[model samples]
Target chain A: MKFNVKIEVMLKPGHSDPEGETTARALRELNYPIESVSVSKVYMVVLEAGSKAEAEKMADGMCRRLLANPTKDDYRFEIRETR
Target chain B: MKFNVKIEVMLKPGHSDPEGETTARALRELNYPIESVSVSKVYMVVLEAGSKAEAEKMADGMCRRLLANPTKDDYRFEIRETR
Candidate 1:
């Protein structure tokens, strides 16, 4: 079966987000009343696996091995069968 | 009222995704059977607006003004009430 996975990777709280802060500043400068902005990365991947359980395991492994930084980032993913 | 807005910005089809390509190659090297990977940016913004309609308008303006590139990127957003 083919599984489509969506993964979101975000920095843990207390970490400074320069890009988001800069973005917010730019927006406020443009006269939009905004409190704060935070940014994250989303990954959409397509892969082959035998079953849903196997696909979930593979997705988890991918996150641990390559998608996120253990010390600084938190990541989660959702999987769905693809035609 | 305060609104939490989630915005996603992605490269439109036909644009090269060097980051996604490099990530997929790294995952494959680690022995994962992955077909393709595409990455997008997600922004979580908190701001004050008079009502849902106003919040939506503000979010849309943000996307149009800075969150996405008109020629190469597509963006969508979701807004929800927050304490």
Candidate 2:
């Protein structure tokens, strides 16, 4: 079976987001009336697995091991069976 | 009023996703049985706007002008009123 996995990884609260801050400043300069900005990475993975549960498990493991930094990032994911 | 905007930016269908491909290769090397991978950028913006519609409009404009490359990337956003 094959599964499609979507994972979102973002910096934990209180972590400094320089890129986001810069973007917010730029928006303000453009007169966008923005208060703040936060950025995240979304990963879409298509993989072969025994089942949706197995796919989710593998994706979660991938997040913990490589996709997210435990000290500063948080991650979440959803898995669906695919053709 | 304040609005929370979530924007997702991704490469168009025909564009090559080098980062995603590299990540997928790494996962395969780790024995994850992955077929392919795609990556996107998600922006969480907290801003003040006259209304949700106005917020959405501003966010859409932002995506078009700066956040996404019109030729190779596509973007979508949702806006919600925030306290």
Candidate 3:
């Protein structure tokens, strides 16, 4: 079966997000009246694995090695069985 | 209106992704029986702006300046009015 997994990674509180902050500043310049703006990184990974346990292992490996910087960002994920 | 913007950034074909490649290798070690796996980055942006045109402008700016490296990534986005 194929599983669709979505992972989100975001800077931990007190961590500088110069990119997001710069973006918010630019939006304000455009007269956006921006109430709030938050930016996060997302990953969409599709994997064909034999079993749920194996899939979970793959997901964990993916997150630790590439999908996130554990020291700077917190990550979360959702997995959907797409047959 | 509040706009929910989803941005996807991907390495252009032929671009080397050492991180993702390393991840794939790790998955293999886990006995995933992985037929194939493709990974892409996703961004969920919530922005409260005054107008759609301004929102579009902000989105473009965000993508070019930070969300992606134009030289290495191809990006596409969707904007939905959520409120």
Candidate 4:
């Protein structure tokens, strides 16, 4: 079976997000009532596995190995069966 | 009302995704059964607005103006009321 995985990686609370901060500053200058903006990453991967559980395990391993930074980022994923 | 908006920006189909391609190459080298990987960006914005409609409008405007490159990327957003 094939699975389409969507993973999101974001900085943990209390981490400084310079990119997000700079973006918020720019937006505020553009005259929108914005409090803050934090940026993250999303990865879409298409892979095949024997079962959903196997897909989940592979997805988790991918996040731990390359897709997310363990020290500073919190990551989550959703796996959906695809044609 | 305070709203939490999640905006996702991804390269349009047929556009080269160098970052994603590199990541996939690295992953394959590490021995994971992966076909392809595509990367996208997510922006989490916290702001206050009079209503959901107003929040949506502001978010759409933000994407149009700065968050996304309209010609090469496709974007979508979700807004939820926050405390």
Candidate 5:
């Protein structure tokens, strides 16, 4: 079966987000009434797997091994069968 | 009112995604069955806006002006009132 997977990787709270901070500052300068901003990476993967369970497992492995940094990042993913 | 906005920026079809290609290669080397991979940027913005419409408008402007490249990228955002 083929599956479509979406993974969101984010910095853990308490970790400083310089990019977010910089963007927020720029937004403020541009007069947008923004309180704060945070940024994350989202991965869209299309892959072949035996089942939904298998797809999720593979995505989780990908996140742990390469997509996210354990100490500072947290990751979540969703898997759906492709039509 | 305060709104929480989530924006996703992605490369349009036909545009090259080097990062995605590199990651896909790494995944394949790791022996995960994969057809293709694409990556996007997700921005989480917390801001004060007069209404949801205003929030969305502001986010759209942000995307057009700074967050997304007009030629090769597309963006979408969702705004929700924060409790």
Candidate 6:
């Protein structure tokens, strides 16, 4: 079976985003009235596994181990089974 | 005026994604029958700028400079004006 998963990782509110800040500064240089912006990383994965339950368990482990930092950031994921 | 922009940055096809690869390996360890997966970053920005043209120009510049790397990545952005 094949599964499509979309993972969104975001910094917890109040945590500074230097990459976003840098981009905002560049926007100002380009003459934008940008005040604030929030940026996060998104990951979409498609894979084949034995079953939905098995896939979910493995995918969840991947997130907890590497895809996300449980301390300062939060992650939400959506999984879809492909026909 | 306020514009809502969604930017999706993807690695040029054929580029090796170590992060994705690492996650895949971990998945195998977790007993998943995973074969392959692709991962990329997504950024959504909401900002207030002077005008549509200026906002577009600034947003474009920001993407070119920081939101994307000129070498191996391509980006697609959508802009919407908020009432």
Tens-place lDDT per residue, model 5, A1-62, is: 99999999999999999999998999898889889999999999999999898898999999
Worst 10 residues of 1 chain A by lDDT: A63-72
- Which residue pairs overlap in candidate 2's backbone? none
lDDT of 2 by residue, B1-83 (tens): 98899999999998999999999999888889988999999999999888778888899889988899999999999888875
lDDT of 1 by residue, B1-83 (tens): 99999999999999999999999899899988899999999999999999999999999999999999999999999999997
TM-score of chain B of each: 0.97, 0.96, 0.82, 0.97, 0.98, 0.79
Candidate 4 Cα misplacement greater than 4 A, ranges: none
In candidate 1 the C-alpha lDDT for residue B63 amounts to: 95
Error of 3 at B3 (Å): 2.9
DockQ of 1: 0.93
Q: Which stretches of model 3 miss by more than 4 angstroms?
A: A1-4, A11-19, A22-39, A51-83, B29-41, B46-48, B64-66
lDDT of 3 by residue, B1-83 (tens): 78888778888878887766665676667654444444566666777767777778777877787667988998888888885
lDDT of 5 by residue, B1-83 (tens): 99999999999999999999999999999999979999999989999988888888899999998889999999999889999
lDDT of 4 by residue, B1-83 (tens): 99999999999999999999998898898788888999999999999899999999999999999988988999999999996
TM-score of the A chain in candidate 6: the value is 0.82
Candidate 6 Cα errors over 4 Å, as ranges: A50-58, B50-58, B80-83
Per-residue CA lDDT of candidate 3, range A1-83, in tens? Answer: 78877777777877877776676677667654554455676655677866667777777877787667889888888888886
Candidate 2: which docking quality band?
Answer: high
Per-model DockQ against the true two-chain complex: 0.93, 0.93, 0.33, 0.89, 0.91, 0.53
Model 6, position B79, has a per-residue lDDT of 80
Q: What is the lDDT, from 0 to 100, of the residue B44 in candidate 1?
A: 96
Candidate lDDT scores, in order, read 0.94, 0.92, 0.71, 0.93, 0.94, 0.77
Give TM-scores for every candidate, taking all chains together and pairing residue i with residue i. Answer: 0.98, 0.97, 0.58, 0.97, 0.98, 0.77
Instruction: Summing lDDT over every window of 10 consecutive residues in candidate 3 chain B, give the lowest-scoring window.
Output: B30-39
Candidate 4 — what's its lDDT? 0.93
Winner of 3 and 5 under DockQ: 5
**lDDT by residue (tens digit), candidate 6, A15-37:** 88888888678767776667766
Query: What fraction of native interface contacts does model 5 preserve?
Result: 0.91
Docking level of model 6? medium
